[model samples]
Target: MSLQEINFDGLVGPSHNYAGLSLGNIASASHKGDTSYPKAAALQGVAKMRGNLERLGVQGFLLPLPRPNHRLAERLAYDGTEAPALRAAPWSASSMWTANAATVSPAPDTKDGKCHLTPANLVTMLHRAQEWPDTKRMLEVVFGDRDHFAVHDIVPPTFGDEGAANHMRFCEGHGSAGVEVFVYGRPGGKFPARQHEQSSRLVARQHGLDPEKCVFIEQNPVAIDAGAFHNDVVSVANERVLFTHAEAFADQQGAYNAILAAFPDLEVVEVPSDAVSLEEAIRTYLFNAQLVTLPDGTMALIVPEECRESASVWAYCERMMAGNGPIKHVIPVDVRQSMANGGGPACLRLRVVCDPATVDPRFMLDEAKADLLEKTIAEHYPEQIDPDDLWTESLEKHVVAARQALLTALGIGELA
Candidate 1:
């Protein structure tokens, strides 16, 4: 069998109604910053997300971060970063460190697990963050790393500016024609100055997208830096844009409603204030990066299910499918630690263009191997093959099988 492409149209977002996969974070020891109750709880949350992804046959790659380093600390401090006084402000270094730390690590070539100074190796690993073993051969031999795909990149205007440009340069990544909400800069944290906004606009123009397509919104006044929550302006798929209605900070509802008004064509669903904690809400608003559209015109959000007690997973699934028919599904990943540290499922998973013909067989094979590998890896390398790692490997195998299956199924090759 050969590979096949799985349509991404319906694979994004969460649902209150249907079942789907989730991703999880590693234990606390794996995270950066001081070990505190908040950090511990976040790690447990990441565990849940990992369990969910494994159950759904999704794959995740793990990126490890070292203990607090002066280099990174100095960079963060010099960047004019601000910490919100709010307990829920999601931009705290501790939380952001948790997220960023997961994405950095000891070099693969380094046996001591020490950070590597080579920029090339660093980029290679970052690319690997989105690589799957099943698709490795095809990607390496046919497409190479230079030709890949990404749905979107939720980047910090400063640090990620060049990264985002590089993504577009190599992948030709573009924005969808749908509505987008831009949350203007917040109070305390560093906001992108007019120059930054202009730079962003220039990038959009380079991609051939209209700058007017973006709608800017304001953040809560009491909250530090409005730019911290800028990512929340648009939903995952670019189907709908969210923004603040009034300039006054702390008006969550008004801001949300304003976003709704901007896109009358979209079915605006209000996320209940009590559904998730302020911390969870802030994380959701900041970290979500994956955007996938379903076949039914509804959207699926692959985000961190912060309040496990309420099952944020099930609720999102339900909301997307409500009245729109049964074509929707929600995939809640456990990145409790990631989210607590200001990252989400979207942040952890980097999107790349996939050839459908090369993916179908792999998907099926992945399903078959998931349980087997899960048991085997868990039994042998319990500490290493965390639930997320197991799923990632299984999914890689599935992609390989999918490619072979597609070829065989189409009679393009002889069955072994």
Candidate 2:
């Protein structure tokens, strides 16, 4: 195949902390005021990337966006007074969840035969809302080859878009034409629904996606209230297989029927709530996993270690594997830092299908680059960050230097 799906994971930032900035994210809320291990978190993320590179033969990583975004901090604290939420917003390392970076339409799915990407507005929350501008800039740098890629600005600020976390694609293979699905939410929920229907529709149109090949589905409000902030928290789709929970959509059967209407070959692996309750599923992040087609022609689910620790979730996996299902293997990884902050395996990545040759080499991974990154993180990253440390001058200097070291080591100081 000339084209392959590359997962671009975000390198966890040095400021990776538990500020409890994200609303509706239970893990983040529960872990507020806890000590954060920047060194271990960044190392774990690189190790995860290393695993994917070994399994898939290629991996890409996005650098951490500037932390304590002094610009945002200046604006929020211009009055010379400090509010806890406003104080923490500037220091959020939430960008590590690259799944929220952008929504991608591979070359095969677009009318122009070139990959198209639109950065998420992420207007729902303050910390995330500060992401799109920097995200768009980095996307343009890596995907700058105009003949092969088209990177669009985020949609108008009126609508909220949370990027690929709320999107899915289905096809015979990553290189073939595919049907895209956009999941949005309604107004009534205890927690604000992050993805809006208007934003999803605009992204589809901007990417030149065929209307007939796009399906829009409503997220289950109950799932949103239960802390499934993004649709990805409840469902994930590979080329032709969709492994999702029974209560994932507002109308689960109807949603499946809609997707099937567009692509008749779709395979559904539904985990009923009866077998594993929604609460247990969210806590373990059972569905927040990567379902990829392995080189050996079998499928594997790369799940969070928490999944293996949960009896119900692990038992369900065993039952699913015992059958002749499409998913053949289940690999569990440790990402406790990210997991505790409301992200699992899937949240740490953004999938873009294209020829590896078209991407900027600096962004792609090799054994040496991995070594350099780990070294920089080990030598420069802070060992631990306490909640009160967000206000310290020393922490600010250290966080900035840590990122600069990584950039210099990788010879991509332009990003710094």
Candidate 3:
């Protein structure tokens, strides 16, 4: 089996809007009540996927989950919730950020020889809390082969589990056995720390990971309060490289010590606070990049175009690449729409390390499929979605029709 990492990016749903549901996310909060461009947002996501497909040989995508979650709407209506935000929550297309979809343990990391995936409970936010049932159904359909994969239901929602956004793994190569790192946070901060220590440990055990190879660490509450809601916003790991910000962990040095104790050859490419402040890092989503290793073995940091717009960020990137570093290329992709909603290249994707042949072909991406997705979005998706546009009968029909069109085009049966 040619074990490699395939980034399955979420196809942005038609209900994409800015109701500002996610707390501790500065971008999402600031953009509340703003009219969102759904077509452009989804297209930007598709374009990013296309870029990845062209850059790497393989790319996969998860479809727009069924939206305007009617059951949720009915329950909210019955509750007679007066809060506009709560009323609008049912229409959230936040699943477009697949990093929260699940936590995956590749074959090499587990005791059994099959890959294990646990859908995140995401119990922290009401909007996201509703995703696991549908998310699990979709996951089982795509990764259904029992011989090569084991897709488990979410760990009990008692504690929040935000999936891969809070998980990282370090290994000598893509196919090698790796040390898994689960980052959690303590409660009591101004903003809720989403990943609980108990939850991370539960997920680690649920995946049947070798206890000796697993390391659970704490996230810096300082960073969380400052809008680094998920660990991905401040750090990302690929193969042997750990690219991160200076203030990414509660005890930065201790976190390094923990990982190093497991994986001795860990090459950390740390960015100091002097060069880029945490606020600036969060704004540009510098750490929330797709740090991928190319076919030729050259590593590339796929960043949001906003990173290039930040003079300081791009300058630092140029300087880093100029040196003989592990990450040779800095590729910028346009995902501005997702960025404005508190997600970036990293947030939009879920990394599953496995053989592509083991995955359902319908879920994979190619040039022709990219064109088909583009055509579908252009023809069916609404141009814009205002907050008020959410409740109307006309818009509901349009959103439903658009998603049905996508499912038909992709040959994916309705998400049950």
Candidate 4:
């Protein structure tokens, strides 16, 4: 069966706040105490998804994970008392980035001819670790067609699987057999390695992927030290095209050689180190830009507004798009709220390749649905959320209520 790649973007949750809970993420730390606009952030994400559906015509939407996590509160034993550890749970909107939603093996690539999805344990960060159960539940409901879609349980926590954030696939087209690139990291720097090599291999084996088609590459320690916590921060791939920074991997040439060996038509678009340093790439999120194929059979680079704000990064993109290459245009999206919290256009989404008919209708969106979600956010979501507010009974009540209203509006029932 022919396939289309669907982008399942996580709607920013109601409890969105900046608490600097992500240890390795620079933006999260830099904007630690800043007040957040939960309503605005979610609307911004909704607008971006609407834009993708309008522009690309093949995108799907994923609802936000329930927040002000009651499970975490129960675990911490927050009996009307405040503790430093309790702060991370209520303010954790990190699940808004569903690229870490799950590691997906499309039906075309798996031996069983069933698309396999394993929700990430996300055990590296406390704030993110609590997301798997809820995420797994959502994935099961959305991709429940067991005949074609197989939703697997998360890998063991010790493995530290981070889902699609560190995984990339390459093939002639979405329907074709392809190479799965699993990028893992070892701890040798200030920033801890999030995705383990063992975790990547385990997921590959669980999905029954052909061993010959699976390639493992270690993330560059230098890149990790420079704050590229996830591979998506410095590299993104679609079809046979892999766009990456010069310093993205430990051995750039070897990674490219492996890709070339498996798929001869591989197009590696490397941003020269001279033009833009790794720091600039991470700051402007140049590599985090989504490299997607439009309906017209040509590719376009969907980048964050920060990329356009930077002279050097935008110029590089201009030059690259000017050429008669696979990438034909550049589109910038305003996800500054998400960017400020260490996510970008690419980070906000999970790419799943499958037949649209197989997905649950409630998980999909069009302009009409986007309008309803926007209306729901306007009605219930808080316009601003201060970190200090996370401690108040009123704020907690509001967050729970807001999420309940949203779920009711989306017809997904109570996920919280």
Global local distance difference test of model 2:
0.93
Model 3: how far residue 413 lies from native, Å: 1.6
Q: Indicate whether candidate 3 or candidate 4 has the larger TM-score.
A: 3
Give the alpha carbon lDDT tens digit for every residue of 303-355 in model 2.
99999999999999999888899999999998999999999999999999999
Task: Report RMSD for candidate 2.
Answer: 1.0
Clashes of each: 77, 0, 0, 0
- Go through the candidates in order and give the C-alpha RMSD of each one to the true structure: 14.1, 1.0, 1.1, 1.3
RMSD in angstroms between candidate 3 and the native structure over all alpha carbons? 1.1
* By lDDT: ranked, best first: 2, 3, 4, 1
Pairs in clash, predicted candidate 3 = none
1-416: candidate 1 lDDT, tens digit per residue: 21211211101110000011111122221342322332233234334334434443343222121111223335345332333111111112221221121111111212232211101111112211221221223222222223222112222334222121011111101122233333333223443211123334433433333334444344444332332332332223333422111222356666555544545554334444355333434434422434444434443455456523345534544654574632254555555534433345544433323333333333222333334333332332112112222124453343234334333433434221
Per-residue CA lDDT of model 4 for 204-236, tens digit only, reads: 999999999999999998998888899999999
How accurate locally is residue 327 in candidate 2, as Cα lDDT from 0 to 100?
96
Candidate 3: misplaced stretches above 4 Å? Answer: 78-81, 414-416
- Scored by lDDT, model 3 comes in at 0.92
Full ranking by TM-score = 2, 3, 4, 1
* Cα error of candidate 1 at position 138, Å: 15
How do all models score by TM-score? 0.42, 0.99, 0.98, 0.97
